[model samples]
Target: MSETFDVIVVGSGAAGMTAALRARDLGLQVLVVEKAHKYGGTSATSGGVAWIPNHGLGGSTDTREETLTYLDAVIKEPVNRERLEAYVDTGREMLGWLGGEGINMISMPWPDYFAELPGSRTDRSLVMPPWDGRQLGDKFPLVREQYPRFKLFNRYSMNLEETFTIAARAPGWKKKVATVIGRYWKDRSTRKMTKRDRLYVSGAALIGPLLARLDHKGVKIRLETKLETLITTGDKITGVTVSHLGRIYDIEARHAVVLCAGGFEWNQELRDRFYPVRTSIWWTSTPQGANTGDALIAAEKIGAATEHTAEGWWAPTMILPNRSASNFEEVHQAVFDVGRPYSVCVNRNGDRFVNEACSYDRFGAAMASDQLATGANTPCWLVFDAVFRQKFTAGGILPSAIMSDRSIPMDWWDHYIFKADSVAELARKIDLDPAKLEDVTRRMTEYAAKGEDPEFGRGSTIYDKTFGDPTCQPNPALGAICKAPFYAVQIHLGDLGTKGGLKADHKARVVDGSGNPIPGLYAAGNATGSPFGLNYPGAGGTIGPAMVFGYIAANDIASRATNRDVASAREPVAT
Candidate 1:
């Protein structure tokens, strides 16, 4: 006999959790299945910000018309207008509902990636504040954790504001750092329980609370349960065949199946098929062995349509060896790190390509375009001088003042970062033409002196200046790379995750090529082609729509159920 539920939500990321929560609110029996031992997927490792425009949180002044106009300006590809409208309306409602349920979200003063675009503003992004993980009790261990690099000393986590302050070395940053560390040490009970901090921040903060609420509602969430296939009766989805402890069994979904299994970033075959750029799947920032597109593949086999099939949430990643384990490598997305002054990313032929201070998606797109044009940009080089090394932090490499170049492990020097005394020497070490690199550096020096980039307009936008050094003279993002001990690190064309998958409508129902909804089927998150197409609007662009659509899907199902119930009540007595 199969266990039955009104809604079966696959994957336990923000989207799935949101769907489960909403379904339960509508008086539905919800079952959430996660493939990993942990519940939250990539969301747990993410920044936990949601790009909810006009949410009225944090004094936001955004309007629906303005927000739509902004989307029109940024998204180049065609998308369903209804889906766009739903994203706007449902996003606000979903976020507001979450807030009322005590899943508190605070707006961050983050500028849109395309701040200069029409309808763009600096108030759409929202992030969860820090929460106490101790409230979760034993369930805390089941929550997915952020990457080690996101934590301080691989133990304590910091909020967005604190991270920004310390990274920018803003006023009272030292005191803030001391307070955080001091407070952690003073909590002797938490330390004794686990090395992980009781104070959850970022992705964990969002997921932790959602989990607590779902538990209170008695929603059953099974971990290490892999969805093998979707059970279908004709054109309608009935349930799913899932494997748990090597036993495969069917679970009946009485009403609907919500596929929120994230993107296929970690799946090599899918990446090779859908991604236009030629790069290893290992370059992705998502957790390995997760997000392999189980939902997408199963849906596709049943004739579900796809869109935006050749893009990702692109970012340049620094490849590094694990310090504690040399045999393994770590891929860290270096979006903010690249925007800092005194650095320039160049192709293999030693030519500066795109604006170094542009948004990460644009920067990564530039890499793809450059690679397709010249085949010399996939493994691009981010070159900087000793001044930059001293002033800014690189991936896994602290500022020289904090952890000097000499202090970095020799293995990094051997396998990752390249350092030399001059631009020409650095070029030689990285296998680039010495003269070409010298010329590029010479041009960069001129650009810095002029406080402008005539080639790519590096520091022209508010978004560009967000990650810059305000202390720098003239343009904050422009600085000369003339100091000795120049460095170069190879940057791979990497991504936060793949952005393409099964196409979903405004109601969050999976649609076919004919634009008809696949009855009893739904999808959200990276599992669906983003309604915004290729555009990444703000800090939480990925998660915002994901959660909104998940909420929409649950409500849509409940609406159908409500109508059926009303119809039954109206039926004439047949007995």
Candidate 2:
């Protein structure tokens, strides 16, 4: 830990650490500086699925052109084609490298969130390797011990749809009866349940192995080492100035400097300036320290150019009123994905605004109307009924794990999530323009009756199709959201982090305004613009790009260093 070596990485998240580890493998010394007093960075708290194409680990020879074709459909804009190709090519190479690093990769061959799109390969779009967490030693706190910076995590993922599905299948009368008994019993611990009752989510799966990989690397990670400034030499970067342990240290970069600090999701000032939604009441699945846009500011001091700083990774994310304190868990799969026999989500006008089954990314974009966020994107409601909430989940999720009140009770439910005895009363409570809601629901009922979608075109994306319930006849992802005594729950525009940042090339070299590489500087993960460009097709898509670029940057730095050593030895001392 005392010696400085070949590489000095700025953040210890997946990208930064991966870069450092790869550099070490290339026979280069590496040092990782972390600002949060932990080694995992944002990746420690991630879903951990790496979206890779044509993994070499499996000996797949999938063509690069096929990969590009798939990427083209997802990303509407012309991407840095070379950088994207590097992502796919190096992603495959990196997968094999992980094997040598003692990581066992696991692949799940399921439909992709964009399977409905072109070149959507249902075969292994994402993977997670079994890693040894014991290797982290005393630094495991930096890995598994830290929960949300603000909240406790004895709850489940509310954003996930399956929790609602389980809750809805419990039988309406059973849920009601259980609720009454739950009040009298006070502690349900008296009832015996299986460990399966405690769910394991995607985030936990990813964070575990990520820590293991760091432990195996023998890398010294200093948390709380905030990157304050970049040590620049004229137009090039030389070293870095970090404030760590209450003292500022001038550290030199022997190889390459990579910035993996996350995007500015929690910074209210930055969010207000760059993002579409303007609010101090932002809700995120990210940590509070995510406020630090150190990478953006630090790189800017030395004139680093970036891409699309206006919009973030926007998603039509849902949130509870004061329930922001906790994401209550319940089961509501039927409402959001199934289109079940009852219920539909409506906005303030009590009208259906988006395909209820759209991915959070696409759905969030469509929710940005002319009035909200100064004609940007604001929050909307997910409406349903007593029969539905008591039977299924509204918005198909329980923002957290436990609802203070399990049944339909408050008008907090109105704007938050409207529930009424009649369609008319629900309309009055939320101040909807009656004609529109009535007509919308009437048509919704007809569609549910036929088990088809027409309005917003639900079940169009592979993501929507994955949420489908095949047991209901046609597509489980499609149906008419029609059940009487409807309701609506409010959702906000939320994000894990923004994807737009310093543009990088195939080598993961930071690019300038004129599209030239910034020497001795590299960026990966959310600190750089997405390799997926503007399109985020599935879950883990972001994580895969982060890992791939991390490896590429490391390889580039190591190869150049080797060549530089050869050049320096041949030259005589000028002095």
The RMSD of every model to the true structure, in order and in angstroms, is 4.0, 7.3
Error of model 2, residue 64, in angstroms = 2.3
What does candidate 1 score on TM? Answer: 0.96
In model 2, the worst 10-residue window by lDDT is: 190-199
Off by over 4 Å in 1: 562-575
Give the CA lDDT, 0 to 100, for residue 408 in model 2: 32
Compared with the true structure, what per-residue lDDT tens digits does model 2 show for residues 108-216?
5555556667777765456454333334444433453323211112322221223333543533534544443443245344223221112223443455555455545
Across 1-575, the per-residue lDDT of candidate 1 in tens digits comes to 35888889999999999998888777777899999999789998898888888787766778888998999999888988899899898777887789877897888878999988889998898889898988888888778888878766566688888888877777888887887898799999977877887887888888999988888777789999999999999889999999999999999998999999999988889888987778788888888879899999999989999998788999788888888897898888787888788888899888888998988988899999999999999889889888889878776677787778777888788469888888888888899999998888888888888989899998988988888888876888888888898998888888888778899998999999899999999999999998889879888989998899999999999887742332322222221
Off-target runs (Cα >4 Å) in candidate 2 are 1-3, 56-62, 129-135, 144-201, 276-281, 321-341, 369-377, 386-415, 460-462, 479-485, 563-575
Each candidate's TM vs. the true structure?
0.96, 0.81
Q: Which ten residues in a row have the lowest lDDT in candidate 1?
A: 566-575
